[model samples]
Target: MTTSSEPRTEPRTEPHTELLRPDGSPVRVLVVDDESSLTELLSMALRYEGWEIRTAADGAGAVAAARAFRPDAVVLDVMLPDMHGLTVLGRLRRELPDVPVLFLTVKDAVEDRIAGLTAGGDDYVTKPFSLEEVVARLRGLIRRSGAAARRSESVLAVGDLTLDEDSHEVARGGDSIHLTATEFELLRYLMRNPRRVLSKAQILDRVWSYDFGGQANVVELYISYLRRKIDAGRSPMIHTRRGAGYLIKPAEAAAA
Candidate 1:
């Protein structure tokens, strides 16, 4: 399998929806692939979405990991060194009948896709696929399988500022605010940890999913963008701690 040639530096601004289990735990996923690099890449991407991930190199390892991990979803590679992916799928279904499975294959043949679906995969993606597509597919699968549920309050509020995870809406003091996908993600992260400082390294790793080789200017750039929309013409809630990082609090709390 080959990795996509697309640049990975830019932060994914997609609506950052946090899916959790009914008990408010991270969604668990098991990824099965022989390529260590591919599994690592996939693990990083999924973890950024706030899902717990475990990986296996072959069919036996996949089954063993699934038995222990009890994943809500599985990303199964069609070609395994020890066994065909279809065999693995059958074994998985027997144990977790309702779990969603997404098949990854190097083959683009129609028969291959049909065979995977016929064997009970919930979805399919060919190799050289984008990480964004894989994460999106897994999100959908997890949601549909009844494994993930919207939090009791889909909206997160810190004082007057509110963010609706479902609608991707942001507002301050009853006034509507607009944000780019990336900006929304940044704001959400800040609001999620109100009053706590988050370092640039932490922000870069969680928001962008990788290190920028010590280039953290992107964080500053996006923070500026958020301040413009979220704090302009008002008592600022987002604040920088010089060398520390950034944090968000209520306007009243900051004033106090």
Candidate 2:
């Protein structure tokens, strides 16, 4: 572990602890790295964003800190002495599956990345990376995930179905529904455009980032994923227009 050449200040209490808005709270983050100097540097950058920050130099400490802090998300290192990052992540998934994970490691191989994702990483950033880039990536995850942590009644309803945007919980006929991260985003977009036709290409453009593998089929996959939860019983609210694309509206919403 290396120390930063710059001066350090005593850490402050995170502002986000009091924040409970759908717009988001100041992020609570766990920085796990074997290098103390790099961890400090990253912590400094994250603090400037007014984020609540904590640091761990090894996998064991990372797990302990995470369990105690209960951060909104984590920035993990792939290498650690006490245990491998992958092992820590597996434990994290079982204990805190909803917390978004961003892996920062030197393992840049494609297979390494696939393994991380399979192990439940939400995003990955290779080491020797820019602090600004890490900050940006972390912000994006927080924006998407912060909703699920708060008690929320703010909802968007088209007909019989409802999506609590603040809570990120979906329901139909008053029963709860669980959706993956991507499925939530896709449904949010469709609900925002209720009764309007959204082409697969448009859905791909909005839901997926530019760097994602250009697989249009991902839209098809998630749409089915949504249906199993949102439309498995009763009449289907989401309809496929054989040649057109896809659209969502309540049968009553259509009449209205």
Candidate 3:
């Protein structure tokens, strides 16, 4: 197996739409790999998509974690120190029969891919693959399996402003607004909690997936960027609460 000299820290330009379980909780995923580095990298990437992630290092751990995590999806490594990944998949299926599984194989042979699929894996990605591809594949699998619903299941609206999570489209007062991936995630976080103050700490944890220490100014910078696109030449919907944090509400509502 080969590792990238420099792994990507940010996801490629794709819809940052959030997916959730039928109960409106974050979608759960299990990642089984003997490599700690690979598991950590995969977990961070998946969390940025707003999905909860659990990792197991071997076939036995994978099966145990699956039963407890009840993951909507699984990313199983084809090679494990303890047992074959196919064996882990078999046990997982016997317990949670319908969960989607995406195999991670170091081999690129056609037969290997077919074997995984034939063994009930929903999809497969070889090593040296892009993190974006894995995320995209899992998103497709979860959606197709009926395990989770995209935010597109319902439009998030705060007054005249509307954001479609599924299409990654935003509009304010009937006019379309464009946002970068980071900007979109920040906006979605604020919109999801309308009229409620969210501190910089919360925003950093939720949107960036890491604490910035004394460098929380990144939040201010992105909030300014969002203001230009979302509030420019209009009655403002996004508001700041002085030392508190930020909030988004209808202009009229804020006026009241």
By lDDT: ranked, best first? 1, 3, 2
How does model 2 score by TM-score?
0.49
lDDT tens readout by residue for model 3, 73-174: 999999999999898889999989999999998788999999999999999988877788889899999999999766554476666777888889999878
TM-scores of the candidates are: 0.62, 0.49, 0.63
- Per residue, candidate 1 scores C-alpha lDDT tens digits across 185-244 of 899898776667899999999898898998999999999999999889998889999999
In candidate 1, where is summed lDDT lowest over 10 consecutive residues?
1-10
Candidate 2, run of 10 with poorest lDDT: 14-23
Model 1 residue runs over 4 Å out of place are: 1-11, 152-256
Best by TM-score: 3
Q: Which stretches of model 2 miss by more than 4 angstroms? A: 1-25, 147-256
Cα lDDT tens digits, model 2, 1-256, are: 3223232334443222222223333347899888888888888777655456899988788888988988888999888888999999988777688999999777679999999988889899876676767776776787687532332336566556778777788888788999999899999788655556788878888888553466777788899998898988666778787766788766443233
Runs off by more than 4 Å, candidate 3: 1-11, 153-256
